[model samples]
Target: MKLKNNHIATFLLSFLLTFLCAIPSIAQTPNSTYTIEQGDWLSKISKKAYDSPHLYYRIIEGTNEKATSDASFLKINSANDIRIGQKIWIPGLPSPKNLTHVPKTDCEIRLWYNYQIVAVGVINEKWMQDGIDLETRAHKAYDLRHKARVNARFMMQDKEAVKTLQARDIKKYGNPDGPTFTYLLNKSMEGGQSQEVAYQTIIDSSSKTDTRYNADCQ
Candidate 1:
């Protein structure tokens, strides 16, 4: 009889422990909301909220299902089509914190540019080899460029600066083709100018070239 009672006590104790352990998971729920503003898109919001732009689907699933019947405020056709002033329910997002801002110095910029040039060169060599179709090479090159830009953003800690650099490069050299980036990189290294100065020089030269081409076309 004592052994039977001991078995019952042990079973109750184990059940109590299991139930207690599961309480936290069961009690936790999604309780946060986000108000949309200008330039607010799911990808950008997810990137800001969750540190990954790929999780935009979570916002759609969490918010749209709970949307009011009128659908005037929370209706979303696509992640890209979110309207300003709409309220979005965001689940499982951590509280927002200020982003760490690293100082942007000339040497850091130059180092980033050097690393990007090398990375792009390797990608081009690997993808542009014989027997690779032009479409495949183009797709690979685009992916490489995106990865390099993301890496550069991390190193530079300034998205605007990276965008400016790429835009200027595109304006000067037409797309971000590997050879053009390599040439500018070599020139910057040899010239010993600050990145700001080198960038200005490239922009000025590109403007002049455009003017000459336009004149020639007339």
Candidate 2:
């Protein structure tokens, strides 16, 4: 059957419009979603995906609007808010490149304690290769840790120093454990001493009144 010229023009025009409209949907990048595992937190997601915990807000911002305005805004504990196979949007996050993920190298780590510069350390290639970077906020934390350890040691050797730290701890962080740094150091040397675990023990012991001072009597 012979088609009218006007009808053929309309058909071709319609086809062109349809193809143009499909470009955006076709070009859209497929989003990858992560299930909330036990111990998962916004900070952890930000760290794993964006390499910075400060980017947690970005993840919140990237969620679908329907998810945002509802009860799931900050309800991180709810499984329905985040579950297996849920299509979450991870916006502006770069895809992994190569067999080994190479973290960005151009970053610096500096630490300040009580508004004074305490220590500064470079984020070396080794740390970056191991997926550790200045973005992790580890260098400043580790610097403070070293400073705390040195101060703790000085306090252990000198009675006056111990009193000074105790006073400072009470004024700033409140209540010092009776067993003190001298005892903690001894315990720390006995094989395993993960800094996090050790710090937790110190905090727990300091908070508890039942724990005796110098239980070892050394």
Candidate 3:
């Protein structure tokens, strides 16, 4: 086991991210096959499949679940834990129709949504490259999260604000551990309210937090 220095760095960063898991909370549906070559990593494999590297955890979950029944997949414990020449499963879970797993009440949504903004804000910073101080990364994200404007924007989500969405029947995310923030931009033709819209609203609301986290949370 000789792993590149970058892989070790990825491991350290991954350890830090474990503080607040941004793992996709959606259910797992392992259906694709991606041959692992040298230099393959979970984030890279996830980017290839989902067009976003942040969702790598989904592949890890999907592959591991598939392995329990088939014994042909690798049980990944970290973002970079994969072997070359091993045929890893490319995870693809069914899209959620509503928030069955997510707390339905506005207050519950508030608690979960607020928690998600901070957790994701810290994760999506992607401040793991060499020469970047981990302390600085942590401090910056913390500071921006409490900034007056950021806090104000976060405060906007209330029971009254999301009244209509609460009435709609949101689909369950299947996986209890997956992240609730589905970055999907799909919309339904049913009318002014939709499952995708409702979930996206929660995700989009965190944009301000994410922007500052990424830009200033260095």
Highest TM-score, which number?
3
Query: What is the C-alpha local distance difference test score of each model?
Result: 0.53, 0.42, 0.49
Per-residue alpha-carbon lDDT of candidate 2 for residues 1-218, written as tens digits (9 for 90 to 100): 35788899999999999998666322212244444545556555666675554445435445643255654433332223565334344445322232143222211111111111111222233344677544343433434444544444343545676677567766754445223454554475465877556544443232211102211211
- Model 3, 92-190: lDDT tens digits are 533333335655543343443444444543353555444445445434443433342333334445645433333331333332222222222233213
TM-score, candidate 1, is: 0.29
Error of 1 at 149 (Å): 31
Give per-residue CA lDDT, model 1, range 20-56, as digits (tens).
8676322212456777776667767776766655456
Instruction: For model 3, give the 10-residue run with minimal summed lDDT.
Output: 209-218
Question: Which scores better on TM-score, 2 or 3?
Answer: 3
Candidate 3 or 1, higher TM-score:
3
lDDT of 3: 0.49
lDDT of 2 at 6: 80
lDDT of 1: 0.53
Model 1: how far residue 185 lies from native, Å: 39
- Cα error of candidate 1 at position 170, Å: 47
